[model samples]
Target: MAIKGSGSPMEAVDEYFDMLIKSRFIEMFGDIKTNSKGWKCHKLGELGSFKTGGTPSSKHEEYYQGTIPFISTPALGPNYIDDSAAKYHISKEAIENCATTLIPAGSLIIGTRINVGQSSINKIPMCTNQDIVSMMDIDKKYDLLFLKHCLNQYIPYLDSQKKGATIKGITVELLKSVMIPEPPIDEQKQYVDFVEQVDKSKAVCK
Candidate 1:
């Protein structure tokens, strides 16, 4: 998979490690489509609760004036996101007025529209726009990082299945029905540890 970029040295380095990490995921869990390893499969809906957020009405000028971080898809980082990652902020009244919910810190924020499959674990409680859905109160049996990677593995397929000719997106039902292999808790932890080591290397590169 060739990643197109300006070909600067820094960009090249990042791309190399990014590809390396992707290849490592494939090594750990063969093709997710076939479940070649025969791990137990479970629908994502069975693993947690899903909440889709809403955008505050732009008609109200006061809605965007408060301290609460209003995270949208662009703010989602590869693994974790904090207040600093967000570009917009809103007031509590915005939450009350809009259909959005106050997603607690540590919840997994997954993009549903436009940039479907992009996700991150929020390090601060935040509100999101209509384009994002969050997984909250995740089942205790599954490791959050492991589940994040599992969702990421489905990105290619999700991208292909996206609807909308203008602002491509996937439905919440599709995201809920997506199946992922469920390895034992210990194995999931082991994968997380490996990821930490690789991330340390990525940090060094930076």
Candidate 2:
């Protein structure tokens, strides 16, 4: 069915839910860039250990023959993803010999290059290309989903920080220096729960 204005029915539904989520997010966190809620702020790097990803040499055909998912900046999605999200696979031998390292499941993968601020949570252990960085061993005081939403709000700021003569990208130092407001753990959980409900509603729209 056609909507009253522009866009198809699906597009209108998606935009409606997008606005709902954004409005609720702003109501809960205020302006994240200015810490408008008067919450204590912490540098993002302080919350976790970060590992820069690396690509294995492609000359070795054997490297691609294994089952481990190899993610890259292009595969860093808007939400949680699993091994199937990636198009490439790497072998165990590739890890032993290549610069790529295995990041644990549930770690957040961020696109430092190309897309600049795109990110996702990996639901399975995987390796990534040089353009991505994985945030692992996060502090327990914060919920993972809470941190993800905070980072999502920083996309515009992060995009502005990208620098390069060719392939523009954000540096680990820049990511580390970026600060985010930290609400109480219970409050963070509540927001995450709210987001989850919104996501379910979005899925129904899809």
Candidate 3:
């Protein structure tokens, strides 16, 4: 059966699941308070390396028209990502010089400059423009999905701390200092699994 919103029950379910996940997340982590200097803090560069992306010089004919997915800040939407609708592409040569560091599938891509903490996990290997920050799991100890949730939790605070007048931005240092609860990997996976199941159930209900 289908529901009214977004023309499909699945869409309605997805929206409901998103809210449920957020609420559950706060219930799980909201009370474990920490002082500003007490939590285990590390700079983003220390945890994982990141690099900016570039535009394949449009003047050159060979710079584009290939299978590589080129993503920009605007592509990171509210809930879903539309990879097929990406705006640009690059040749093997452009990939070599411009976006050499390929963001592996499932890694979190964060927008640091304008939007601050907006992030999404790429389901396929892709490259991003300068405005995005791709974070790979350095030690496999942290769940990528959990980290994404943590980032989402911190967005409002990060936005409030923006120092730039004309162009607000968060430095690598600031991002790193943002504390995250270091739960066991198994527990993290369980949380993710539970959320996924809730999403599935919502879909069925709708």
Count of residue pairs whose backbone atoms collide, per candidate: 0, 0, 0
TM-score of each: 0.93, 0.93, 0.76
What's the ranking of the predictions by TM-score, best on top?
1, 2, 3
Candidate 3 lDDT tens digits, 8-55: 656766766777888887666562235332435444456666665656
Would you list the rank order by lDDT, best first? 1, 2, 3
TM-score of 3: 0.76
lDDT of 2 by residue, 75-113 (tens): 775678897788899999999987789999989888899
Better of 2 and 3 by lDDT: 2
The 0-to-1 C-alpha lDDT of every candidate, in the order given, reads: 0.86, 0.85, 0.70
Q: Give the lowest summed-lDDT range of ten residues in model 3.
A: 31-40
Across residues 1-206, which tens digit of lDDT does each residue of candidate 1 receive?
Answer: 34576387677767877677678778888877789888899999988888989999999989999999998888764788888887889999999998899999878899988778989998889999999999999988888988898888888888888889789899999999888898889988988888778778878977
Q: Residue pairs in steric clash, candidate 3? A: none
Best by TM-score: 1
- State in Å the error of residue 53, model 1: 0.7
TM value for model 1: 0.93
State in Å the error of residue 84, model 3.
2.8
